[model samples]
Target: MGESGTGEARPPSQMIDERIRELGDWRGDVLSQIRALIRQADPAVIEEWKWRGVPVWSRGGIICTGETYKSIVKMTFARGAALQDPSGLFNASLDGNTRRAIDIHEGEAIHPEALKALIRAAVDLNMSRTRR
Candidate 1:
């Protein structure tokens, strides 16, 4: 179960929906867009609410996490360091050994196709690993 800010326990999918509603701002819009792209890229992707309030997207393993903060919405990829980001969508956590993140601020425009490509690549990476 995922806990809301109010400390109420609920299903992760339901909690994620409420979190999007609760944001009620540009962050919500960005997160929503990201979610849509992820779903478009991989229809089989699973959404899980983890680390208390974060929105996590996974396939064979974690693909990325959506973390909304005061100034930005961060999408952190679990094996981002190993992925080839030709579009350079990842702008945060670049120095990390295992993860990479894309930080979107207010009014920032996301490249739909580029993000979808990234999401697909992440899913492929997870699937390949699981097959081993």
Candidate 2:
């Protein structure tokens, strides 16, 4: 068997790049920044396309999803409720039982290092769950 032996498959990272380029808006830039930070946080992170088009990043399990809407770019953490957020970066979907999201508006300032820490925490949380 060869690399294409499986089927006609476009790489997940390329799909995500297309999605970002398709936006052609501030959301695209924000999502790109978030994506970069995720990679910086975990160089081994896996990018995935799921739920009909959403961009998801995973390590041991799903770490987060990048969902862009008209007004905001949302980064939703899968095990956010179980992780510690001392910097209070999570500003959306806070009431949820499991997921937590950070909504990035056009003018809002994003803390790159803080966000990276959060990403690492999500990865750690996912790893802990998988081990147990």
Candidate 3:
């Protein structure tokens, strides 16, 4: 499809660019950081705006998602419950069964190495799932 304003054709999955452009100010920083992390971790991974308010990356299956709220940026892994999170970054919510999240507060620092490890693990996990 073509971009609404630019009229330049884009891949189907990237059609969500418009939604990303519409994200409010509160979410911009978080989204930028998430995109940077994804690019640093794997330059080849495909990024798509999904779930209305999240940045989603995928290879064989969904890798992870980043969402923003008033005070925090949350990164979630689709199969997070299965990942070996030695850093204890995974936050197990009371209502979920296969997802895990890491919340980053304003002014807080995110460990790039740790984030990259998690990203790599997520990609590997998705690849393994597709192989089965």
Candidate 4:
């Protein structure tokens, strides 16, 4: 839980909603779309706010984090290096051994099916790790 502007403790989901509304621009729209896509991909995914208000989606473990900057919306996939991204959605953080990311700028379009496949793969990888 994080404190709101009024200093009240709030759940992560509520905090996420506020963060989206607070953006009030293309970044907000992008974040909102990403959130919906993540939910559609994994209905059991959990929403979390971490490291000072970043939105994280997880199932067995973290699927991705939705982070916003002034010029781009970044979705950093945890354990992304382990997932097979056949559609080539990962354009950022490719240098890392254990993580990958997709950076979306204004007017950029995300391939929904491809992103969903990537997310499902992440979930599968997480579950496999959990069972091990």
Candidate 5:
């Protein structure tokens, strides 16, 4: 378990405490914005630890995740390559073989509308996959 700056403790494996501790002011602001986008998109989507340091959102299968690196905050979708990205918000170069990402550079504002659309698309896609 890890202790937050305020001394509240949480499970070590969850790593929410560690992540909060590691995020300095600016990064925390970025993370909060991303988190708000996800929540607004799907109020029912649950948050969980996935792929070690990433924050994952899902209803059935994985939906999306947010990670903070040295230069940017990366929000990745699990089946992003399969999602229709009409807005071209996701960047292919930053994606893994099965996932795609939107990289928000430092000091840049997150596109909340675009993010909500992506999250809704991802949830619909996952629901379709489960039905088949």
Candidate 6:
């Protein structure tokens, strides 16, 4: 499941594990939690390492990316602007024309069901475009 953007054949999952372990703090915890949720949401989701260190998930098409900052763990959906967010989980990158993101802080709590719905929606969106 590990696909390298730099032509490296290393498993992306291993790289992600190293990144998470490197964080070794709350941000790591948050990232790990969200990663688990994403995997749970789509069992077939592929884990990839992009831009050298970013954790990306894709299926049919790009679904989302996991990026961590000092104060937040950002999950940016590839087609977020096209998905419905009735739960209002998207609190960051709200002004983009075609993308959306959820910025989670150290103590922030994520709505698992809502996030699962979002992941499913992203997958559906990707699949829809691929079918065309």
The Cα local distance difference test for each model comes to 0.93, 0.91, 0.72, 0.93, 0.77, 0.91
Assess the local accuracy of residue 80 in candidate 4 as a C-alpha lDDT between 0 and 100.
91
Which residue segments of model 4 deviate by more than 4 Å?
Answer: 4-8
How many backbone clashes does every candidate have?
0, 0, 0, 0, 0, 1
Candidate 3 lDDT score at position 27: 58
Can you give the lDDT of residue 66 in candidate 2? Answer: 96
lDDT digits (tens) for residues 11-41 of candidate 3: 6345444434666554555666667887798
| CA RMSD per model (angstroms) | 2.6, 3.6, 3.4, 1.7, 3.8, 3.2
lDDT of 5: 0.77
Clashing pairs in 1: none
lDDT of 2 by residue, 1-132 (tens): 112346766788988998889999889999999999999999999999888789999999999999999999999999899889999999988898999999999988889999999999999888887898
Q: Model 6 compared with the native: what TM-score?
A: 0.92
Model 1: lowest-lDDT 10 consecutive positions: 1-10
Candidate 1, residues 15-109, lDDT tens digits: the string is 77888999999999999999999999999999898876899999999999999999999999999999999999999999989999999999999
Candidate closest to the true structure, highest TM-score:
4
Tens-digit lDDT string for candidate 4 (12-117)? 8898999999999999999999999989988999999999989999988888999999999999999999888889999999999999999999999989999989
Candidate 5, 118: how far from true, in Å? Answer: 0.5
Give the distance in Å from residue 79's predicted Cα in candidate 5 to where it truly belongs. 0.4
* TM-score of every model versus the real structure: 0.93, 0.92, 0.77, 0.94, 0.80, 0.92
**Model 3 lDDT-worst window of ten:** 11-20
Model 2 stretches with alpha carbons more than 4 Å out: 1-7
TM-score ranking, best first: 4, 1, 2, 6, 5, 3
